[model samples]
Target: IALECILLLILQQIAAPGPQESADDSPGIALAWKAHQIIRSRFHLPLSTAVLAKELHCNADYLGRVYRRTFRLTLTEAIHRQRVLAAEKLLISNSLSLTEVARQCGFSDTSYFRQIFRKHTGLTPAGWKQRYCKEHINS
Candidate 1:
């Protein structure tokens, strides 16, 4: 339930226009943007707030706070969102199994992947794949 709420909040944020950046926060906002870019490229690897903070040369708490302020979502939320989006692309035309998709998306656990996928898209991975397969037989 907590995960569902978080996912919903993230979706809402993405759906809505984002907050404008304050001049005072330009540096931190840049850091957050860079962090997200890094996450997109390396999200399939084991990543954590501490690791991201270290990479960005900022305190973990500070990074989280600024990122949340700038993006209205946490780093973890962003990561999970990216993973789910990536999984959606793969599921469209790929024949990978659930486990493989999870692994490819940096989810170490298949069940966790399913849970996040459901929270993000309101459908389990299998259900998503089934629906897509039926709609697009080219896969």
Candidate 2:
């Protein structure tokens, strides 16, 4: 339920027009939005800018540039963010080990998963889980 709410919020943010963007969306904005949807749906898979661009029938560089410009983040960062969000929910709601959580969240290696998780959340997966559980249990 928490994960669903977060996903919905992210989608809403992506769909909302930015201050500089007009009501009539540009082609790049449209493409970026499509990319965002694809990232959300297929986040559990091995995703890359090349793979996404191929699926979206656009050039990889163009897609990367448009996605970065539209969202102010790189495509790889977006994918990592989605995976980390899902990982956070799994960490709290399941008894899965860190390796299992990393695999299930589309991270190819546990160490890499830890690195990215800490980058985003400022804590290791286990640390984040422990802190979160402690905080919620006391509430």
Candidate 3:
């Protein structure tokens, strides 16, 4: 009986995430990880805070608060960052025009896409393309 109890305690300790932790414990790190998964999987779609909250099984306000705290940026800002990074890559491809790049990155308006791109990069889409082209030629 003593050996059985000892073995059970050892197994439980080994299975736990940390000291004083319960098996059902959900930490901020876990929540942040789930949030990242949800964003990556659904980011290209037109999604609202309510929709993301529902998908994550949290309140919109709470989700936004925790997400911003965890990522140091608001949910909308994070999505925009992702979209603009994608747009920058697309701009380099030379196969797709700015309109197509905007559409592919889930931007509903080309003008809005250009605006956001410029806001994040300090350069408009055309300027970014031109700078990259100039750098390549100089190299």
Candidate 4:
């Protein structure tokens, strides 16, 4: 009985949301969280909204609506943000080139990738990396 109780407690902790996160965040927030999990689960693979929708058991349009409404950003924007954030981490800690980072982050075109990075971050990828490294070194 004690072992079962301990297992249940552990499971509960694993499933529980953060203390600062409220249960009433929104339907979109819930959908975004689910989407985030699905993306992370298949991070190594090429993925799309159609694929994600199938995995999530929802229509692509509905998923997009929920995602945008909940997060105040389009699904594409959300996905790009995740990809860029991953790229940022790699840029800071790894020796991968910009093209390599773009490829690894799901951007097939190097030029388009640079444009998107600049659009989102207001800095070229190289500039972002330089500033990031400088900040870290100073800190």
Residue 10 error for model 4, in Å? 23
- Tens-place lDDT digits, model 4, residues 55-83: 88878998887666554666677677777
Candidate 3: worst-modelled 10 consecutive residues by lDDT: 21-30
Candidate 2 lDDT, 7-62, residue by residue in tens: 66785587567897777657887899899889988898999999999999999999
Candidate 1 C-alpha lDDT tens digits along 1-139: 5985796577445534347544677677778777877887999998888999999899999989878876788999989998998999898868888899999999999999999999999999889888888888755
| All candidates: TM-score | 0.80, 0.84, 0.75, 0.70
- Report the C-alpha displacement of residue 137, candidate 3, in angstroms: 4.4
In model 1, which runs have C-alpha deviations exceeding 4 angstroms?
A: 1-22
Order of quality (lDDT): 2, 1, 3, 4
Regions of candidate 2 where Cα sits further than 4 Å from its true position: 1-25
Worst 10 residues of 1 by lDDT: 12-21
Candidate number achieving the greatest lDDT relative to the actual structure:
2
Clash number for candidate 4 = 0
Candidate 3: what lDDT? 0.75
TM-score for candidate 3, please give it.
0.75
1 or 3, greater by TM-score: 1
In candidate 1, list every pair of residues with a backbone clash: none
Which scores higher on lDDT, 1 or 2?
A: 2
